[model samples]
Target: MDRSEKTVLTNMCMIYDDDGNVLVQDRRDSDWGGITFPGGHVEKGESFTDAVIREVYEETGLTIETPQICGIKQWPEDDGSRYIVLFYKTSHFAGELKSSEEGEVYWTKLSRLKDLPLARGMELMLRVFLEDEVGEYYIYEEDGEWKHVLK
Candidate 1:
């Protein structure tokens, strides 16, 4: 990696209901557009937590608070660029649902998640967040290959 290389910082949030269903987005215009969660890039000077809240409001027309930092997912590209996706989870939020330019927002039961089309690596991140054993870890990749653990 060189000084000119960049690491992009983004955030993702998984909001669930009492019955274990989660808020999901059926994306049609994004790279990983499919059945995904609410989230986007963290703007300049914005904290990761605040970014998730802002994203939730912008993408779902809802106001959420105290989203717990669950995990981090990173992928290094062949062009020397890197992406850091911060994952969060919240069972609390308030507002009405609204269609977003990003995608069609709705809820899907956890039991049925496997039956839907998921964004690339969505299952990995979801597993990392939902399972306690995985707690926090980072994935280092190059040319679309997982090169084993770094630590």
Candidate 2:
């Protein structure tokens, strides 16, 4: 099996400030390192929603309220080699922000995102996720290529 034959599960949280800017992280310990939402892996035996809350707090030190399940980005494979990212969001949160070794946490105007350096595929995901639609999404590889099938 090649590098493509691997499975990973992760979660991401979009925390917005009162000014409506999104809290982003400059990742330091990830494969695709760059600007991204405050999130990380879903520890074994943890629920998706719980994972988001924990990840957000660990990375940004903000205790998030009920995180609404936004949507899912998944790459399905027969051999279980795939990536599934459960996305969550919560504007209602408390606690002072704290940066982590994971990266520098800061707030940036949502409109200014286009001018910043975003991780690969994050820009597109952010655009789609910002929309009103929260339907189930599917992304997989076929014939050595990737495809998107949204529902």
Candidate 3:
């Protein structure tokens, strides 16, 4: 069996408030509707930290302080393509929230995050972030069922 090549990537800013509420967005484009965090693909030559800061600023108009890595999610597609997404968290930021090509932004209370519609993988990831300590690394399969490879 041939294992698919994996693309290592970073998604920074599970932006949180002092109270621990996370920031979520509603994608304006059909390609990415519903609830999601503010982030995107890391550009070449750009560090993961820098990518997240830039993405957050572009998507939500917020300038985030350096984010701390929280978790890792692996999405392996059937077409032999895989995306290893690095998740980060940050509570320090500045600027007003605004809409962008990415989506409309909102700060969601951690307790109510599940009440909102979110990407399939997000619900589980959020739980891990809340229940666990400050930092951790987890690997998940792309299947609807999230299988953890690390704690």
Candidate 4:
């Protein structure tokens, strides 16, 4: 029997400033609409780090430096394909902050994140990004019920 499966690669970055604020994008897309980090698909032939850097710049107009991979968020699609999101964080960046077609980008205090309307599953994803012990956030099915985990 064949056991190979297709996968999709994507990324997201949590950019921080000296003032304890993090950059967030108020996404306009309906699929995962609401507040989230700036990121996008990893193009074919692009390295994970490179893809995230390009994505951050395209969506936020700021070029990030030395982005560190913190964790991963993944889930299986209905068609049997898997979707994975590489999570990154960085404090070194340059360029004037500007919003792109994807959304309005701005800096907000980390403490205020809980007050805003976040994208679906974003709250759980944050656990992997912020907690040192959590390396992966994912969803799976068992006994016909879906379950989420942070490991």
In terms of TM-score, the best-performing candidate is 4
- lDDT per residue as tens, model 4, 1-151: 9888899999999999889899999999978899999999999999999999999999988999999999999999999999999999999999999999999999999989878999988898878879999999989998999999989
Overall local distance difference test of candidate 1: 0.83
Task: Select the stronger candidate by lDDT from 1 and 3.
Answer: 1
Candidates' lDDT values, in order?
Answer: 0.83, 0.82, 0.76, 0.94
Tens-digit per-residue lDDT, 49-126, candidate 3: 999999999999999996988777665566666776678888889999897977788887978888888865566677
* Steric collisions counted per model: 0, 0, 0, 0
Candidate 1 vs 4: which has more TM-score: 4
TM-score of every candidate:
0.87, 0.84, 0.79, 0.96
Q: What's the lDDT for candidate 3?
A: 0.76
Candidate RMSDs in Å, in order, are 2.8, 4.3, 3.7, 1.2
Relative to the unseen true structure, what is the C-alpha lDDT of residue 116 in candidate 2, on a scale of 0 to 100?
A: 88
Q: Can you list the residue pairs that collide in candidate 2?
A: none
Clashing pairs in 4: none
Model 3 root mean square deviation, Cα atoms:
3.7
How well is each residue in 1-151 modelled by candidate 2, as lDDT tens digits?
5566676789888888678699999888667888889887988888888888888989999999989978777877677778788888889899988999999999899889878889877866784468766455677778988887665
Better of 1 and 3 by TM-score: 1
